[model samples]
Structure formats: C-alpha cells, structure tokens
Target: MIDFSANMASLMLPDGRSVRGPICCEDDIRRVIGQVADAYGFRGFLVLAVPDTGCNSLEANAIMTTYPVEFLKGYDSAGLINGSPVIQRLRRSTIPFTYDAHQLARRRADGKGDAAICVFEQAGMPRGIYLPVHDAGGHRAAIAFGGDRPVVSNDEMQELNLWAGILFSKLVEVRERDRRGSGSLSRREVECLRWAAAGKTTSEMARILALSEYTVNHYLNRATRKLDSVNRVQTVAKAMRAGLIN
Candidate 1:
C-alpha cells in the first residue's frame, strides 16, 4: 500500500510531493486519485456522473477514470451500468456500500447477473466500494474503488466517503477550469494521442508514423503538457474527452 497522509486541505503523494490544497489541473487530480486508491488498498478508481433517465452511454458520463480501458469497454458493452445489481443499489441508496461479484450475481434470479459478474471479475477487481456524490449543480455521480481485498469496515467507509466528497468537489472545479481554458493540440500531437489511445507502444507508434521513437515520445510528452496531464494515460483520456482524438 502507498504510504501517505492527506487532509481536506492537502495531500502528500507517495513520491513525497506535496499537493497543497485546491487540485489545479487534471494531473493533480489524477495523482490525488491514484494516491487515495493506493492508500486504501484499491487497484484503481473511477469517478463518473450517474446517468439520468435519458442517458444511455457510460462513456458519455465518465468524468475521469484509472480503470483499465479494456475493462471499461467490456463493462459498457455488457450493459453493466443498467443491469448490474451494484448499480441498482447505487440508485436507491445514499450511503456508501461494498460489493463483490458473486454477491451481486447470487441476488439475481434469472442468472443473467452471472454474465455481468464475469465481465467484472475479468477486470481483476472482484470487490469494491462505491460512494455516492453530487456535483455542484446537484447532479448525481459516484466514486468507486475496486481491488481484490475483503470489504472495508464501516470506519474505513467513513474515511473513504470523506475523501470521495473532497475529491469529487475538486474534480468539478478542475473540469470547469479545464473546459473554460482548454488548449488545442497540434496535428502531430493529436495523431500521437490517437495511437496511444489505441494501446500502441511508443515504438509501434514511431514505426507506424515513420518517426523515431524519440520523436514519438517528444510529441506525446508535449501533448501531455499541453493538456495539463501527468502521463500518457491522462493525456489520452483528456484528449478523448475534449474531442481532440477519437
């Protein structure tokens, strides 16, 4: 687990960097989310807006996520957002909750839940905690932490719930700022991000683009900075969200 201390005002990253309050950008929020997940024994976390009655796509509501890209694809493809028992619980409950794949599967009578559970289990995250939250505009959203460990205690839930609120609130702030002051990516940067989103390695991208690996990395790095992202993953996520790349 990651060793760190955090408060409403500041967070100490595992690498000893101090992000003192007010997460200013996507990169800062990503670091905060990663540190919080590690400190809580989770493999990764996802923050997304809860779809209302008219919303049909998970990708449309996703805020930011550290979950594997493939896992998300499978989850959306399986229609788990609407069919999964955990989501059912999320819709009705205001309190934080913990669930495992089998627990949810067993609750369904038609046995279709088993298929959904399989998709979740394949992500290597069999259990997780979910915290319900609201945006500044009062729209519902949730934060989830998933891993292989047993369910967390109520005390742990309380702590995580507090962290979730702070994180989500800061997320709203950062996203608003990002949208208001978004930067444009160059054509080469957009191409690099598109390939990176496709799971291409730097070397593979270089070969495909007929550029040196160093040149590919340079473009990616520059794109990352332009997007105020910490790494390639965040860069791709941000670029995709901004409609700069598919």
Candidate 2:
C-alpha cells in the first residue's frame, strides 16, 4: 500500500503540475492508476469512456485497465452491462458510488442469469467504487477501483475523488498530445481500428460494419499506412496511443 499522506503531499507542485513526474505515455497512467488502487486496498482499476447509451460493451469503451483480460472477455459475452445497476447509475450520476455484485444482481430487471455477477465473484472483486470524470471534449469517462474491501469513509472518498480527477486529466492531456502528432484517421478507419483492437478479425469487422472483406481490409490498411505502422497490430497500438480508438 502507498503512504496516503505522502502521496497527497506530492500530488501538486509550485506551478500546479503533477509532482508524480511527467506522464510521457499511456503506460505511465496505467502504472500510476494501478499503484494508487493497491494503496487504497483495491485489487484492480479500469478507466473507460462511459457510453452515451448503455448498449455498448465494456471492451468497446475501455481506455486502460488492470482487470483480468479473461474476465473482460466473459463479461462482454454475458451482455449484462446494459442491465447493470452500476452502469445505469454511472450514466446518470456524477457523484462517485460504491457497489457490490449482489446489489447489481438484485437491481437488474433484464431476466438474465447471474453470469455477470458470478464472474465478479469468481474474480474476487465483489465490490468497488466508480468515479466519473470527463475528457477534454466534455465526454464522460469513469475510473473504477474494485476489491473486497469494506466501504470507504467520507474522507477516503474525498481523497480518491481528487486523485481520480487529476489522473484522468493527465490521461486526456497525454492522449491529446499524441493525437496532434499523428495523422488524422477517417471515421471508417477509426471504426476498423477499434474493432481490431477489440480482437476482431477482418472478416468479423466486415460483417459487423456491413462491409465487404475487401473494404474492411482497405480501411484497415489505409489506417495502418496513415499511422505509419508496419502492420495491423502496430496500427492498433499507434491508434490507441493517438486516442483515435478507445
């Protein structure tokens, strides 16, 4: 666990910059979020773009995460996000809140099995807190810290809120900086890159977008070249770094 008092003391410098040092890249943000989560007694953290609608999967909007990949895959497959009380509350409320799997299961009316809740239990993260923030464009985003710990006190919540706000601000700053350096990507290209990053194949992307395989390849290839990447994998990395695709 981090020394919370010391961390707060180092949070700001004379000029208002982070005393945490320069966040030169996304990995820096991930590292900081992970370390902070552990200090707060959380086992995992996720930073994601909150969708305008509840229909989107977690994988589609995730910016950075310390959650298990297999759990993410299973959660997406379960298709319970739209029905999740946690997600619904997140969409409507700006205030941070704590949630548990049982509450999520009881509050949902979708008539689905407890697969999603079970997954959470199996992952050993039955409870967590969600802190909402926004990007430079005023788009809503959130940071979630999950663990089996007891509810945080008011003082702790206040500290976490300040940290989350500043962390997300730094994330937007870094992404904007990278985006300016990269060439512009078309909407179609961005769509293809997003799917690719989600682990979709060319054929799958084509089917999902109602385009031909040739067209999907065309868009992806163009995006790759525009980003000056050597291949699809590298293209995804570049697009992610540039914030072209979340």
Count of clashing residue pairs in every prediction: 0, 0
The residue-level lDDT of candidate 2 at 163 comes to 81
Worst 10 residues of 1 by lDDT: 1-10
lDDT of each: 0.75, 0.76
In model 2, where do residues sit more than 4 Å from their true spots?
A: 1-9, 12-21, 183-246
Name the TM-score of candidate 2: 0.70
Each prediction's TM-score against the native? 0.67, 0.70
Query: Could you tell me the lDDT of residue 196 within candidate 1?
Result: 94
| Model 1 ranges off by over 4 Å | 1-22, 54-56, 182-246
Which residue pairs clash in candidate 2? Answer: none
Error of 1 at 136 (Å): 1.9
Output the TM-score of candidate 1: 0.67
Q: Write the per-residue lDDT of candidate 2 for residues 150-222, one digit (tens) a residue.
A: 9877777777788888788877877677567658776677888999999999789978986546457766776
Model 1, residue pairs in steric clash = none
Task: Give the 10-residue window scoring lowest on summed lDDT in candidate 2.
Answer: 1-10
| Model 1 lDDT tens row, 26-54 | 55776687788887788988887777754
